[model samples]
Structure formats: C-alpha cells, structure tokens
Target: MSDRQRLLTVAFYLAKFNDEAVRNLGYVNFREAFNELGAKLDYSPNSVKNRRDDFDPLFGHRAGWHQIELSKSNLEIVEAFDHLSEEALRAIVFDLLDESSSKQGVLLADIVQGRQAPSYTTRGVTGKKAEAFFINWFQDHFPQDNLIDTRDFGCGYDFGVIGSNEVYEVKGLSGIDGGVLFTDKEWKVAAELQDEYHLVLVKDCFGEEPTVEIYSNPHEKFSPKKQVSTTININWGISVSEFNELDKE
Candidate 1:
C-alpha cells in the first residue's frame, strides 16, 4: 500500500477501535491499539484529532478525517472497511473483539466470550483465506425458512431475532480456531437476554451441521476470564430448562 493509504488505514482502524472503546467507557487496549497503528502508519502524535464537526450542511463532520482522507475517491472501499485481505480483516476484527471485553464489566465480558463449544474444532472454523467467509457463509447456509423468519441485512456477521417471543443471537464463529469470543458489553446483554443468545458455531466449513445452542442463562459454575461486573451475579441454579438435563449429568 502507498504511504498515504497506509496512513489512512491506520487512522481508520484507530477510529473504529476508538468508537468501540468509547462504548466501553474507555478501553486501554483500544487506545493502545489506536496509538500503535497511528505510529505505524507514520502518523505523528499530533495527527489524531478526537472530534468531528458539523460545519457542512449536507453531511455532518466525519470522524478520523486524517486517515479517511486517503480514500477520498473510493468511498465504498473506505466505508466498508473492506480494504484488508481476509487474514488481515480477521486479525483486526479479533482485536476489536478482544478489546471490547475490557470495556464492559467482568460478568458481561465472560458472558460474551465464555460461550461454550465442543472441545474439538471442526473444519468449519479454519480453511482457505476466505475474506468474505462470514458474509458468504451466512448467505449460503443460514436457515432460509421464511416461516422461521430468518433474514440477512448485508451487514456484519451478527444476526438477531425480531419479535418479543423471539429466539437467538447467531454470530458467525467461522474462521475462528473453535474458541469463542465476545465483547463484555455484548455478554451483559446476552446474559440479561440469555434466553436469546445462540452461538452459531458453523464448522466443517459451515457444513449443514452447524452447532446450535440457546443460552437462556449464563453458567454460574464456570469461571469467566473477565466479567462485566465487579461483583459476581452468578446463577448457581441451572435455570434453562433445557440445561437442567445437562445439569444432572
């Protein structure tokens, strides 16, 4: 990449990380990653300006102008954050996921990342460097039953339910080495809405047999790497009726 593009890429990921960090109140890793990338892209410390303005009428001030200005013409490429190769994208995304946990409290963090999977990871998690793997995988394989009411927004890998009596949160665990990851904030939400959280473990290259488990409650017994709350709000009882069977074993 040209120096200009490199500069822009650093700025771009920096902004992305910062945005999420703010959501997390202030993530040190996000700040650190932002700083690291900023330096790598040859952005001097002064280059980062942490505010956007609404000076223009048509469009409000955009964030990360210093970096975004690189792709002034290819708006879509910049907008999509799709400039990176598949591996690069995954690495960047994983970093985002990693930093997110610290933002939320400990319980929330655990709920998000502590999702369980089979001890064995399937071919579904690893393979050729498919850049659009999650997108394509979902579009190709997710349940298309209209009666089931599944839909794709051409958005990111995370998918959700609609109405009140709704069911799950199916995020693509594709391309991961079979471990699970989630932001602490997301985990808090999942634990709060545990009845709906589902880890769409698409393995065997997202083969037909994707592992499906509905987590209506966070496991109290299992230890979380980091939780969203300072105090543990663990559920000692196996509440999910489905899990009651497993509890007995």
Candidate 2:
C-alpha cells in the first residue's frame, strides 16, 4: 500500500505479461521476458544488463534469477522481483528438478533490485490439502462402492472401469475457462488403449451442478468442441460428441 509497493506491483504485472507473451510466441527459451519487462517499464536498454556477482553476497547461492541493472540520469536502480513472496520463489528454482514444471516458479530476474524475502510459513494448505482434494474428487465420481474395479500405484490408466468399458483420463479444468484440454499423448493413448476413452471433464468444482461429460474415442484427428469464452463467444467451436460418444454406459 506504499508508493514503492504500488510501483513494484505494476512492474511485476508487466513482467508476467512479458513472460507469458514470450512463452506463447514459441520463444520459450529466450530472454524475451526480461527484455519485454524492461521495455514496458521504460528502463534504459543499456541499464538492463544483469551481473551474477552482485547478488552473491546478499542473497547467497539462492539468488538464481538474472539481476538486471536499471540506469537513469541520476537514479541508478538495480532491482527486480515478482509479486510472489521470496519463500515461494526459491522453492521453484532450487527445489523443483526442472523449474519449468513448477507453477509457482517463474523467471525471477524481474524482481526489483532491493526487495527482501518474505518470512516462510511452516504450515500451509499446500501439500496435504492438495492430495486430499484429489482423493475426494476421484472418490466422488468413481466411488469405491459404485466402481466395478479400482487400482492404485501406477495403474495403467488415470482411471479404469470394467462395467463402463472405458479408460478415463481425468484432468483439472480449474485453471482454464470452464473448458478443458487434452495433450497429444492423452488423445492418442485414449483412442488406442481402450474401446472408449472418456475424457471426464470436471468443471465448477464447488458450484451448484458440476458439469460432467464423457468423451469417447478422443483421437487427435477428432477435434472436440472448444467453447472457449473469449471476449465474445460463450461455448465451444467444436462439441464433444463430434468425435466421441458422450455419456455412454
């Protein structure tokens, strides 16, 4: 709520915009994210250069993000960071095997020159809550009492049932707009592995009536309805039943 904080918040938003743009443009490996941030922030091009040796003293080896310096006429500012707390930021870079898999992890160089790390919380609704949520979700739809058969620990499918004669590939639709997506592997695997590959999309998790649809024969050739709610349209350009049999017993 302070002047510095307000300015920093806008800077981070622009940083996220720049990073996401870089990823989407298929220049996923480039430094476009940082460059875009500098451009949007109106930082001098020459001042945007980063030096690793500068952070070694203060942040220690934990400082993994490239540090870019911003030079103005009299104001020589060398700081950058995102809206995330530092505890959240470090776990992404050092903890995760390949940082890209981390949803919490991001290109950290955008963090301003002198923001301190936030204190760590020993207890949070992060790990166990996540596992518990998944368990409840699976049980709700494919309850043990109702299921024909269920197996754990590297079961061949995400979920399999004998009575349904289907292989279910369930995915979280919480992030995307009330719609879902299937990877090329999931699409092909679903088609060839079983007679019917049910892409059971779970949306509006706690909302009044959760929407559930069965996508049968989800082949890559079969483009399902992607009723993405963009600026205008409300539903998909394609439908589930176009290629797959829907809600079959």
Candidate 3:
C-alpha cells in the first residue's frame, strides 16, 4: 500500500472510535484531531473527515455515507485490524505517528562514535512533520510524477522522485540553524550517488511557516568531519540452564 493509503487507513480506524479516539490522541475535538493529523499526513483536513465518514457507517456511530460501499482499501483495513482491541489499535497508530523512534539505530551509532545524541522531544520537530513538509514542497516544486516513499525499505534516502534519478534525504530542524545527523549508510549512499542524491532540509518545522533548503550532491557541497572513539562493546548471553531457570520463574 502507498504511504498515503496507510495514513488514510489509520485515520479511518481512529474515526471508528469517534470521540474516544480523539481523547486518546490528546485532541480537544474531532476538528483539532483532523487538522493535526491532516498536516502530519500531508493531506487536507476535509479528506481526513471524508475518510472517517467512509468508515463511520460500519461502526454505526452516526449516519455516514451509507449510499456508497466501502472501497477495497477500506475493506482491507477492516480485515487487517478488525481483531485488534481499541487500545492495541491505538498503540499501533501512535507508533506509526512517532517517527522519531525510527532513529534509534542511528542514535546508537552516534553514541558509539562518542557523540551526544539529541533528545527527539527537545528538538521540537519530529521526523513525520519534516517529512510531510518535504512531501508537500516536492509536489509543488517538482514535476507531477510520483515520489515513492522508501522509508520502509531501509534505503539511505527517504524518497525516490519518479521520472528522475534524484533521491531525496530529508532532515528536519526546529530553526534555520541546527546540526543534522546522518547514518553511516546514508553517508555512503550520498557519496556513491553524488549528484543524483539531494539533501532536503526543512527549517522552522515547528512554526507556522516552514522553509525548504535543497542541496544537490551534498557530499561534494560539504566536507564533514568524521569522529571515532574506542569503546568496549558488551554482549550478554544466557545458557540453556539459565533459560530453564527463568522459564520456571
């Protein structure tokens, strides 16, 4: 499924729960919930409400668009998440929205290099928010061709713009000036792709107005200093006896 479809499915599920979903997500009301989620998902607020109304009939919360049948995508969503309890489904939604958690592996590498990792919450800009900004900006500035989301592929770049060889790596900052972190794989890919790779920075992402700065061939544009540190790595293992003892407990 496309990233947008996944987001729509999440919104549909949230709509199924109605007011409870709004409360659980920390929104004062459905309007606020729709607006916030719309921004994060790079969709219009009305679209979110439409998706919600599409699913509302199934739950019998209110008179929704009962004239039309559920689309194949909506049916798939129901089949997939129908078995989950409200809490479990909400947890899944929360995890999907918490894009910062995806950086844990990169943060570990930074720690190994003796660099202090920045707290995600303190940054005041989340990965999802930055990505949404980039998506909207790309759609506006670039050709109308598709921009494929490669985040789940573990690729160095976050998006591959169709009809071109260019790949975009997005970084979000609360302000115009701030340090951006890169993973080893991303660095290597940037060097390999050279001019084909682009570094897209979204600045002032937490503010009403966000700005986009694009650098083509970032590896050639900036020379980054590499830091190394010698540290002991610890690994813990349990034997069969220990496992059995723990299992008994």
Task: Give me the candidate number with maximum lDDT.
Answer: 3
> How many residue pairs clash in model 1?
16
Instruction: Estimate the TM-score for candidate 3.
Output: 0.48
Better of 1 and 2 by TM-score: 2
* Model 1 agreement with the true structure over 1-249: per-residue lDDT tens digits: 233433443344444444542334233554565465445545654453331111111121232222112222222223334334434533433343453533323433333232332333221123121213444544566556212333343222244434333333344333234444444655665556554444444433334443433344443323456522222132235468868788889
Those runs of model 3 whose alpha carbons end farther than 4 Å from true positions after fitting are 1-125, 228-236, 242-249
TM-score of each: 0.28, 0.32, 0.48
Q: Per TM-score, what order, best first?
A: 3, 2, 1
Among the numbered candidates, top TM-score falls to 3
Cα lDDT tens digits, model 3, 1-249, are 344554755676676788899999999998998899888777888888888887765566765654444554564455455556777677656755666654533432333332333322221124566888889888888756789999889799999977788899988776566667666788999999999999988877767998998999999988876634333233356799998999999
Which candidate do you rate higher for lDDT, 1 or 3? Answer: 3
Global lDDT of model 1:
0.37
Q: How many backbone clashes does candidate 2 have?
A: 15
TM for candidate 2 is: 0.32
lDDT, model 3: 0.70
Whole-structure CA lDDT of model 2: 0.37
